[model samples]
Target chain A: MTEGEFKIIFTGPMGAGKTTAITALSDQECVSTDVVNTDLEQCDKALTTAALDYGHIDIPGASGVRLYGTPGQERFRFMWPILASNAAGVIVLLNGQHPDLDEHLSTFVDAFWEGGRMPMVIGVGRLSDDDFFTIDAITEALVERNINPPVLSVDVRRKDDVLLLVEALLCQIEVNELGLAEA
Target chain B: MKQQRLGFVGLGDDTASACLSMLKIMDGRSGISWSLSDPDAADVLMVANESTDETRRWEHTSKPRIVVYHHNEPKPSASHVLQHPFRVMQLLSVLEDVASLLAPTQSQTPLKTDLPPSSIQAGAEAADVGEFWDSLHELLYGDFPAAAHWYVAQSDEGELWLDARSRRFMADPLLLKRMMHHNIRPGVLRACNAPATEGAVACSLFAMSWMITPHLPAGLSSWISADSAFQLLRWPSFGSLAKSRSDLTLCALLTKKALTRDQVLSLSQAAEDDTDRFINACAMSGLMRYDKADLQTLPGVSAEAAGSRFGGLIKGLRSRLGLSA
Candidate 1:
């Protein structure tokens, strides 16, 4: 809400396009630590994001937004809570190629929040492969699990796509007045 | 013409022996360079242990057709071999796959070329050492899934801690039946029948470890741990029930058969540690050979028809437990 008072955390499994999507939208200096993901046994062939990635985005009217990307590996799940502290909101990214989207979402939601309520949850469905899932389908699946949060179909590489997501999330944050009193 | 060569870094006598075994069956066009102690000796680097920090360092250097022959641990970035003797053929098949991909070209493209070369090279005498390292990292790190596959393919056996009896079930199912016919219990049978695949075996072991750990509630968890035996049982053609839940599903299905509590306990007696207690707990939950027979009544089957059903249940249980000797 205030300048440098909060930040959006990009979290998801590896190769879900968190870094590329963040960099595309960021207008200011973006600090990122990206090691080429070396374990492709269970991931996409041409996709990788090894460690943490970071970027700063200046909203057209609101305060500049700082985006932090966490390592997508399950091994780094311990870092989620630490990053969630002093967080503006959370975007749980999905690879779309994953066979069990509902199961994956349940696992992520349970692991990320520990049943504790989290900030506004946004499901960013990165359309990969020819067979794409509609935003309504993804949102409906989330809603079944009581995760009736705003969901979006996004292309992390496009500035307009990221801008639209930022606007949608900001509007939700306004109605809820998230991170305002805390700041 | 000189034969195309492969190098080894941590190639010990054991690996050398295994490679020699493969070499015996392999066609004679390719050559191998053995490294007893030298990390740089081989045209193909073999790291049998990934936990040692040195393996990562080895990744930075050593430009050989790399094959990692180790169990799943931390260090080495590339391939691993299977841990079982039966899987040696499977491992070799995978190696052949990798070798075909990494085989040096006839032209042997130079170490440096135009941007984004499809193939990359590094040298001991090369001046572009920095560029070489970066290129090597990209070349190796970029294709990690392929490398990990090679690693799984090369490892001799996975890390499964089954006792002697359990190991026999895996090595030979008929032997398990023989032991069961002698009245050996299902827990002991399951302990011996852990599957060959690493991921499934690992998950089973993890669940088993929890089930057998000192203080947990015994039934469902314990039976779940011993589920690996069920995975082995599905070799020829699995039924609808077994396919649904692997171990847990099998336990649930067994409950529908309706055996007596004592019969379940008798089967449970063959199990070692908590696996038996777990089965006993399941029997108590009204699954398997255990049905609603009042323990207060006269012991054993009262009717000839009941005896026949019980006899059939024992046979089915024996086969399911890998005890059909």
Candidate 2:
């Protein structure tokens, strides 16, 4: 990674829409390795990402943003550290409608935070009006686990929403990088 | 463009006249036009505060009756109900409901012109657009488990796959560009994940847009947790959308307190998936508000009273069907 370039990774459970968010924000063609989903019992979707998703966005005067998405299944856990290496930040997306939403949040947050706390943001999707897991509740759960990050409600399908996550992550990275330079 | 006749029986003169006035206002707003006179010829009957005897007599005649009552009174037996002090939106919703029942085979017919005429183009083009959305609604909400599977796949795969159900592909090879346009690419990709042919990708993309574009309200992508509490922003008018009995019961329960989806389902006979869809639709339409409060703990209802209420509701439903309890 060059001085002007930074890498951001997206990680979440099988149906959290991380790949969709990367596709929404990527400036160029996205590379994906989705295969026929044989794991229908665990996730009701027709397909699943077999490998990593890759895309890039140009940052003015900066080297640019390289976006990577990790496969959501646990079988691909080995790839998480590989994708997170040299990454400036991680964005965690969770499916709000999932029955075990809190568990999903805890699992992903722990995985990403293991490499020493990187600038991270959480985006939750597919919420209904009567949903029990609100932003505040999620934030509290994170606080209880001693991992505090900016949590947001997002729809990966919307470009602006995806961009908002990117912008928040970049801002956090800049603050941390600047603080290190001053020290 | 079918004319339907509606009549009110057993309603007080004041209530009947008030209802008639509201119907007149809704005459052209809804797809169906209405006539107030001639109860004998009415395709649907509105029975408000009618005695059990009168309701029984009307029930035997085979006309679908909408029973109206106050909150304090015991609910009557009928497929539909309208509360006192009606709103125009509620009345329009009921009329639309009856129209759908009367013509279940006319799936392509536009239920209501939700958009104003000036905004919608006239003639064949307008009808085509209406029919397209109607089909999409059926595809998404109707009994096709394949559509649900596609939705789950899209949410999982993001932009990597295409839906086999879509009928057109974007002219541009840049799938992301097309995806950015409609924001449903993830689901599209998932639906087409196992497509037998490459052409299925394009077809599924086309179908995906048809299904998603018209329905995407701005800023509606947030996830709803199964345990969250909710408040109703507006009264759900009966027969407005194709709601099941469980959907109606859930809506009614929402009027009382901010209840979790699980709590609501536990109290009613609604299936888990249908309750989820109903809650999503309500949230998207701005008919509900998410409450931050945890689920409220209430005193247990005495078994005796609970059984009586349950029995009465069931009996009313049975009586409406002209079946003896």
What's the count of clashing pairs in each model shown? 41, 29
Model 2 has a clash total of 29
Q: Which residue runs does candidate 2 get wrong by more than 4 Å?
A: A60-62, A129-133, A180-183, B1-325
CAPRI band for model 1: incorrect
Residue B34 shift from truth in candidate 2, angstroms: 50
Model 2 per-residue lDDT tens digits across residues B1-325: 4788888878876567667755643444445678876778898888876567666678667777788787678866667888775544456556766776887654443233223222222232222322333333333333442332121122321333322132223222244334434443232121222322222222223223423433444322245555567655433322111223454445445533466665556654567666665665565334567756463453222223242312332333224323322
The best candidate in terms of TM-score:
2
True contacts kept of 2: 0.00
